[model samples]
Target: MDVRLLAASAAFALVSSITPGPNNLMLASSGLAFGFRRTLPLLLGVQAGFQCLLLAVAAGLGVVFQRHAEVQWALKLVGAAYLLYLAHGLWRSSSTGSAAMDRPIGFFKAAAFQVLNPKAWMMCLSAVGAYTLAGAAYWPSVWRLVALFFVLGLPSITLWAVFGSAFRAAFQNPETARRVGRALAVVTGASCLLVLL
Candidate 1:
């Protein structure tokens, strides 16, 4: 793959990966409660999941979904429902309890989340459309594209985890932590909804 093209793709991937969204919000929360070390699964999940989505999109699956209005609507509905479910989970947890916050979410669950995540879809669409070269050798281009996103994605997601871990110091009380978690959850879900709009 061309180095210039690779660099450009990586740059675009960084912009999307680092941006505020549901994934970032959840990462922040996880990092705060579980610390960067524990958030590794979540970070890996984000990269692996997006990598799959990018592959699918490059294979023209996104175009298929884009062509079908009903399919798109169904995806939105599912995404909304999932966000609400996440919101409820966040709300039910202790607002300030460090014990409750210590455990990060499991890997499989986080990986599955990418399927219904609107933000993930948006990122994939953007990457496939903007980064992947149209006329270049298909396999090389795809590999390079995937590499660009993966390279930027891991660090970007980790940063959110670190941000969350950093916030731990601010909430010494379980009650305060619970309240903040609930609030962050709400914002996270809301951010997902905005992608549908």
Candidate 2:
């Protein structure tokens, strides 16, 4: 891989990973509700899931997506529905502070969620297409991009979680927490628009 291309890929990974999407939004919400330590599993899961996604895209999954518009549409519909469901749950939990809110998203669940995350798909597809080389150098280049993303992305996503956790103290009051939770839920639900687009 060219050093310049690798550096550009690193910047892409950092920006994409840290941006406010479903994963980061959920991570922040989880951090606020569960604190950083409790949210660590979800954080790790996002990284693991995204890496798997990037690998798959590098290995030709992007071709499958391109060839089958129906499949992509199906994924989009399902992803949008799932995000709506999660948004509802978040909204409800904010109002009642339900037992469901007490439990954070687990590692496996978060990992699996990548399959339905449109942003993850976009990031993986874009990264693989843009950063990789052809033929003999392809695998090596892909690996480099993967490692770069893994290194840069960790701290980027971690910042989102930390940002949310930082607000935990201020949101301790029931009313304040509920208001914040509801707002987060709205944003989460709105993210589904990105999926459909």
Candidate 3:
């Protein structure tokens, strides 16, 4: 395995995992609404799901996506729709102290959500295509990249959840929490537009 490629893949994984996307945004909302302890399962679920995705991409799933443009478009459509649905839920929870607002997304649900996350797909495809070498070194390089992502992604995403949790004190007031939740909802919705574009 090339050291340079490994380093590059590490950097890519860190940047992509830490950046605001559907996963991080949802995690932040979960942290703010439910606290970090409750959000830990969701965070772990994302890592599990993303590592699986990376493995799948490394194992030729990326080839299928590259060959099927319509499939890619369909995924984007579904992902955008799902994001919109989640944004609506967040928006609704902002106004009412309902049971739904008290519920944070669970491990299985969060893991399943990765299948519909366009950002996750893009990250996997790009990493597998750009970082891994061919021939005898292929599997080794792929494994290295996966390990790198797993190690780096966890803390990067944790930071988002932690950041949201930090605001819990400030958002102790119901009105303030509502406003922040609504803002997060708007941002989440806007991310859907980006996915579509």
lDDT of 1 at 95: 45
- Overall lDDT per candidate, in order of appearance: 0.76, 0.88, 0.87
TM-score of each: 0.86, 0.95, 0.95
List, residue by residue over 1-197, the lDDT tens digit for candidate 1. Answer: 57787777888889888988767877887877777888888878877887888898889899997888888777777887877766666766654353434377777778877777887887888877766666657667888878877777788878888888888886567767777877877786676558679
Q: Please state every model's RMSD to the true fold in angstroms.
A: 2.5, 1.3, 1.3
What is the Å distance of residue 163 in model 1 from its true position? 0.5
3-84, model 2: which lDDT tens digit per residue?
A: 8997899899899988998889878988888889999999999889989988998888989997999989988998899889
- Which has the better lDDT: candidate 1, or candidate 2? 2
Q: Candidate 3: lDDT of 51?
A: 89
Worst 10 residues of 1 by lDDT: 93-102
How does model 3 score by TM-score? 0.95
Show model 1 residue runs off by greater than 4 Å: 1-7, 94-103
Worst 10 residues of 2 by lDDT: 93-102
The regions of model 3 sitting more than 4 angstroms off are 97-100
Candidate 3 versus truth, CA RMSD in Å, comes to 1.3
> Candidate 2, residue 126: CA error in Å?
0.5
